[model samples]
Target: MRQTELSITVPATANLGAGLPGATLSRRLGMVTVRDSRPINPNTWTVTVTSTPFITGAGSATQTIPTSRVSYWSGPAVRHTGGGNLAPGQPTSAQAQTLTVPRIAFRKTSGNANNRVSWEPTLVIAIPSGAVTGLYRGTVTHSVS
Candidate 1:
């Protein structure tokens, strides 16, 4: 299973309150979950934010009020690896996989439509040679703003 790439899915829903009457809140939601593959295998992971304030609409303020790009997520991939770590100014031993959301319908502030977002993430975990053996733990955040 080392070379066989695995697949994971991350779902997202946009919610806006009191948004501009003519503006749209629809934005693409993407996510990537990271895991550690370091114990006797690996077990550590990290989430890094590359960009924020993604926009998608007509009013120009599309996704600004309360919008943000997804960092990395968590998945079963962490069970096999310890998810690499960044010490001081060094390269990480492991990497956090990325999840991309190419499509999502934003909930305009005026529209009383359901705008709650929830998603399940899938991650690829790699096992290193000198990993330790132990119980690892982590968490998954559904929203940012």
Candidate 2:
């Protein structure tokens, strides 16, 4: 018997461009690919995503954008292969969830024998009224299990 595992592939970087205070910046974080090769009964896998606060300058309140202001929507699978039931966490912008905590970005249920799921998740950041203008950096992490 061979032991396989779940894996994920994410983009190196994503830029949401510039936004003015009290404005919203939205962009797709490129394609995220989740692969499951584990041969197990009732094979199921989930991909969870989380992000850190975007900060610049001296990291003061005005220079920070909390993770709670960052919204994520899995939208739909760009493409998939060898699947079971693959679903998006947030199917629409109306249902987009904030990144305050780790959230299920995508999942697969009841599939076996090597499956792949790919999606382009969108991120929407609501710039606070007091936000300062500068380049902000944050980390968005994706994990599969």
Off by over 4 Å in 1: 1-112
Pairs of residues clashing in candidate 2: none
lDDT of all predictions: 0.26, 0.91
Overall local distance difference test of candidate 1:
0.26
Each prediction's Cα RMSD?
20.3, 1.4
lDDT of 2: 0.91
| Deviation of model 2 at 63, angstroms | 0.4
Q: Which ten residues in a row have the lowest lDDT in candidate 2?
A: 34-43
Q: What is the C-alpha lDDT profile of model 1 across 1-115, one tens digit per residue?
A: 4432222334444232222333332222344332222223222222322223333343143222222222232222222222232221112213332324321111111212112
Pick the lDDT winner. 2
lDDT measured at residue 61 in model 2 versus the true structure, 0 to 100: 98
